[model samples]
Target: MHITSGSALYHYTRSGTSVKKLYEASWVRYCAVNRSGDKIFVTNSMSELLTLSKDGTILSIFTDRQLQSPTAVHVTETGHVLVCWKNTIIQVDIEGNKNVTSLAIPNVDNPLSMCNLGKCIIVGSSNILVLKIE
Candidate 1:
């Protein structure tokens, strides 16, 4: 799976001829696929969390007025979705309840990308920021 600007998610088959797409948002900063490959969590530079089925079907959109600049997203092994804002991480449960985490990558100002690596979150930006989580 790969994402292009202008808010598009593309899934390509082996030979690269077959492509599946989800083109519903204006800007998709990052996306994470669930372990079951049944759901996808997407985010932009703003505060909307979009959920989609693997077939590109729109499932749900979650947003919180308190969130600011939600620049990146990651999905954990336990089916929880984590979104990284400027200085916080918003954790969303399957029921859509939002929990904010005061997690950060030290001195980095831009937590623009992220992924789950076992027990830690590997932050993405111009510099590498790795933070361990309980």
Candidate 2:
């Protein structure tokens, strides 16, 4: 998968065939595909989270007021969508749909990116933060 800033998201097969393309006018900062390969979560410069299908269809969009300057996104192995913005990380529980929680990471300043590694999550900014999942 590839994302072009202020443009679109492209998905290519292993053989280099372009399978899907999602066009967006906003500046796309980051994206994460779920473990099942059926859902794609995207973060834009406008602090919005866009949920799309594997075929690039818009499924849902989260534009909560608290999502300020979302810089990174990741999908956990258990299917939760993690969005990093400002000094906080918001976990969108996909199973419950309504269980959204925010976690404040100590000493994390202006987090720029994040990814899941086994049971832990690594967030990067000027410094790095590793959080173990319980």
Candidate 3:
């Protein structure tokens, strides 16, 4: 599926058609469509963490006020969602609760994108940042 963000998620159809309103938010900065296309990982650049179905039904939302400028997000194999802010990264559980892990990240300059590669999380900023979490 081709994702073009403009306030919502759009899925490209096979016949050159596309589905609109897949997901709606004020600041949907980045989205990761799961390999199955059943679940979605969405980050609002100015708001909350959103987990939703392909049809736009929100499965959950994490309301932590710390979610400011959430530039990117990735879902881990262990089922945790990692959200990246300007200089920090936060983990969210399945229940939409923010995990209390140490928010300390060293020498980050404007984090911009991220991806989960099973065992570790690779983040992209002004430069590339890789964190190995066991």
The lDDT of each candidate is: 0.71, 0.78, 0.70
Q: Please, what are the lDDT tens digits per residue for candidate 2 over residues 2-95? A: 5545567788777878776775755776788888888888876667788888787878888777688787888888888988777888888673
Q: Quote each prediction's TM-score.
A: 0.79, 0.87, 0.80
TM-score-based ranking? 2, 3, 1
Best by lDDT: 2
Clashes of 2: 0
Which stretches of candidate 1 lie above 4 Å from their native place? 95-97, 100-105
- Residue 93's lDDT in candidate 1: 75
| Root-mean-square deviation (CA) per prediction | 2.5, 2.1, 2.5
Better-scoring candidate (TM-score), 1 or 3: 3
* lDDT, model 3: 0.70
- CA shift at 125, candidate 2, in angstroms? 1.2
Ranking by lDDT: 2, 1, 3
Q: Candidate 2: list runs displaced more than 4 Å.
A: 15-17, 95-99
